[model samples]
Target: MPRLCGRRGNIRRLTRNSQLVQNRWLNRSAEDQLTDNENLRNQIAITRTNESQEQRNERHRVNTLRQRLARQRVTDTL
Candidate 1:
């Protein structure tokens, strides 16, 4: 009887090689996602740090003023 042992060996080797390639791809994708998450967190922290109470109040005040002016303009147009 002819041995089919070589075919089995080739199949095992191919499976192992495919698994290794898939694992590497997944690891790289996970690493990139982690880096992106860290960057977003850092940006959020910076934005929070930059918005002090005084600046927030000023921004709110400006927005309110603009809204009032817009209403006035619409009334004038009508």
Candidate 2:
């Protein structure tokens, strides 16, 4: 007999005289929401892939540059 959201007896009372006058709220256009959802998903996926590629490229560039600088420093110091 325990209710779900910690309101045990409240839902039981509401069910007794329910005329269902609580479900009339249009928040936004469904088409706009759908388009927005699709756009967001695509943007997230593309951004993630671009970021991964950029990270890999940056690592390669940094390692290559560091090695060249280190070799030059060693030759110059010796």
Candidate 3:
């Protein structure tokens, strides 16, 4: 009877420890997922800003080229 009781106690302790480890792992997983989501959001924002800047640069280049062509046409007519 004493040995049987000791075995039961050991099983209970093992079960409790396993539960604690599982809880810790779950909490860490949630935290890591949240961090990953935030980082992805930041990356998307940066990409949008970079795209906006690139579009503006392209527009400026096109306008400059158009102006240069107009000037060349005028010089040719003269």
Candidate 4:
């Protein structure tokens, strides 16, 4: 009999990969993490500077919504 592979199998593979990546990041040295964060902030600043006003507004709106939802989740868990 042939085995059936579907969404469940794909999800398991993805979850495993995500956990591995998270573990690697968590294991990185403090200095390496600091450097990575600085580079990320610089890239974000450069991208924001190049974005149009409309794009900036949309990004800000999305970010605000994300933060609100995140806060709701934390409150719900408390």
Candidate 5:
């Protein structure tokens, strides 16, 4: 009885969902939705890869500078 009453509650009434849910919800065209999901996943993967590459480049630059400074000190002491 409680479960039946709960189903009749005002909050249970359907309303227009927010934009994101509207876009990504299961009821839309399956092919288009899948494509959108794939594109989003690919973008995130590319972003992570680019971020990793940038960190690698920064680390390489720092190492190169450290090596050059060390060589200069050694040459000066000779």
Candidate 6:
């Protein structure tokens, strides 16, 4: 019983910490967010540039499937 209670308390503490981190990110200025997004896009572009043709094809196929599934889900919910 005591062990279970301790686990619950730890879970609550972790949840609170994650919420605090999310709130901090949301509170950042618009310029800061834009810069972060630009940096991420640049990183992704660099990574894609290094990938071989096979890897690029696989990534494209996976992305296409994901988009198709997402669209199907949206249509189902409508």
What TM-score does candidate 2 reach?
A: 0.34
In the order shown, the candidates' Cα RMSDs to the true structure are: 19.5, 19.2, 24.5, 4.2, 18.1, 3.2
Give the least accurate 10-residue stretch of model 4, judged by summed lDDT.
7-16
Give me the displacement of residue 3 in model 1, in angstroms. 93
Candidate closest to the true structure, highest lDDT: 6
Model 6 agreement with the true structure over 1-78: per-residue lDDT tens digits: 556665566755667678899899989999999999999999999999999999999999999999999999999999
RMSD of 3: 24.5
Clashing pairs in 5: none
* Model number with the top TM-score: 6
Note the Cα lDDT for every prediction shown. 0.85, 0.74, 0.82, 0.90, 0.78, 0.91
C-alpha positional error of residue 61 in candidate 6 after TM-score superposition, expressed in Å: 0.4
| Candidate achieving higher TM-score, 2 or 3 | 3
Cα lDDT tens digits, model 5, 13-45, are 554565557556757787887899999999988
Residues 1-78, candidate 4: write the lDDT tens digits.
Answer: 656578645745667678899899889999998999999999999999999999999999999999999999999999
Position 78, candidate 5: lDDT: 100
**Per-prediction TM-score to the true structure, in the order listed:** 0.39, 0.34, 0.35, 0.61, 0.35, 0.75
lDDT by residue (tens digit), candidate 2, 10-54: 665565235353332235578867988999999978876778777
What would the per-residue lDDT of candidate 1 be over residues 1-78, giving only the tens digit for each residue?
755676574755667678898887677876787998899999988986899999889978999999999999999999
- What TM-score does model 1 achieve against the real structure? 0.39
Q: Candidate 6 clashing pairs?
A: none
**RMSD (Cα, Å) of model 6:** 3.2
